[model samples]
Target: MKSELEKREILLESGTNEVEIIEFYLGGQSFGINVHKLREIVPYEPEAMTSLPESGPSMKGMLLLRGKTVPLVDLGSHLRKRQVENSVERKVVLVCEFNREVNSFLVDGVNQIHRISWKDVKPLDDFFTPYKPRFTGCITVDGREVMIVDLEHVITEIFPEQTIFGEGEVEGAEEADAFKRGSRQEVKILVAEDSNIIRNQIVSILKSSGYEQVTSFVNGEECWNGLNMLKAEAAHKGQDLREYADLLISDIEMPSMDGLTLCKKIKTDPVMKELTVIMFSSLINEQLAHKCQEVGADGHISKPQIHALVKMLDEYCLK
Candidate 1:
């Protein structure tokens, strides 16, 4: 069978608001990751892996691939679920990239790819509230449900130092501090991010930086509904939506409705069109940057760049 990553690339346009997911199995449960993040799929070779000392349990070890040493993460172990027995020799490894860093995830097997609309993927927040559910969203494929793995969160958990506000991560600490002191504390900001850890971190960062009036939602759908409610209230009070929420910072890979779709909707709507929308995501590459622009996003920032996000907020919202 063709490896999941070996399938023909789906020719999705820049701003069509669609994604291709590579489904795989771990501990008998179907899970998926975005195809765009995948580099390739390789057969797992335990003999080829070099064990690391003093690493996390999920950090299986490192594997040399194409002249580079890549860390290997056991997906099942990382999820704290039943481990995929190494005795079963025919295991699969998925090589993926995020925030310009590459890593591999070990899984039981690879399934075929599926192209789906962001609308089909439902956020876990609709069902429950947990710190980290391991999976960001769930999708139904041919009567079977598949959970989308929160790969970025997984990697961050393994390497906490990669977090946005980790030590020595602030690019312009002086300027950021100045902006926070000089900025208006009354600026209402709406943040839409599915990852609970990231959402809370962003909220905390914004609050500490003087953005006191901040509201957060888990996904674009929730954010959109919240915006609609605010719009209704603004209309009833004969005030602009900006008076209620001046800016929106959203992740691009959210479920129900992605950030690009949200930006497009906000920009096209008469009431919310003027609201400043910033695309904040790990998937913000050159092509994705163009997509953000095509969807009417006012600004774009790559992930794990808290300082840059702050700078953008100051430039667009504080000014």
Candidate 2:
């Protein structure tokens, strides 16, 4: 039988701005995760997990599945909440793949999947502190709001060394710096990412890499509005939109409007189509990459590839 992820991937057509999320529970709170990230769901077996020495509180240990060892993270512990007493009896592990890494999260129980438009999802940054790491957005399903987990952020916190901008991970930083300093000061890049942490990190990395003229928005709708303002300004000055912005770097899964929808809108527009569009997202895979190409995106890069992103900017924008 096809896994839920595979089935959903096949059912979801590209550029539709829709997502299927797997709703789950942890500490009596509802949570959601994009189905594309899920590899499979398995019943939790205490014997299957081997505890690691000196592991963090949330690091439940490693699980051996099909000759592969995957780390297990306790979702309840990470949220700093006490799970229900009978959680273990109904526990399940959500095995997910992102940024070419596989990990599993232990949750209290699994609920039904939901298919909803990206517009229904709302950014949580406006209501929460910038430091909150667990949730990226919220969506109302069946009269209740389900908070979506920022799985990438959780994994990054667990393994800090895996960060893309960490020292020694960025190749050709000097060259990228030189390009930015020498002739790319006027190149404006617009970034759209819903997660405040990821968005700030990306902006910081870009500025540190010497790309100073960068503007950021919390979601695709904001980005679209920003682009329109730039268009209006450019038109008033009798200049092209490219004069105001050279490229757009967008996250795939965002509230109000998705990156693919944003890219499609840009490509479909007469003037906006001239600007280069790069899908910078953790959701990038063979299927999603094809979607980017279909929407006329100039390129696609997986999340946490700060070095490669700078290199691309140097080669494409600076040149």
**Highest TM-score scorer:** 2
Residue lDDT tens for model 1, 1-319: 3343344442565445678898998887788999877888889988889999999999999998867889999988888668546635588899887786889999888878898898888756655455345677788998888888878878878998776556445444434566565564868899999877789988887777677789999888899999999999999999878789989999998877888888988999988999999998888776678878988999998887887887788788766
* Model 1 alpha-carbon drift over 4 Å, by segment: 1-10, 13-17, 45-48, 80-89, 123-132, 167-180
lDDT at residue 93 of model 1 (Cα atoms)? 91
Worst 10 residues of 1 by lDDT: 1-10
**Model 1 TM-score, 2 decimals:** 0.85
lDDT of each: 0.82, 0.84
C-alpha lDDT (0 to 100) for residue 285 of candidate 2 = 86
Q: Which residue pairs does candidate 1 place in steric collision?
A: none
Residue 22 of model 1: what lDDT?
A: 84
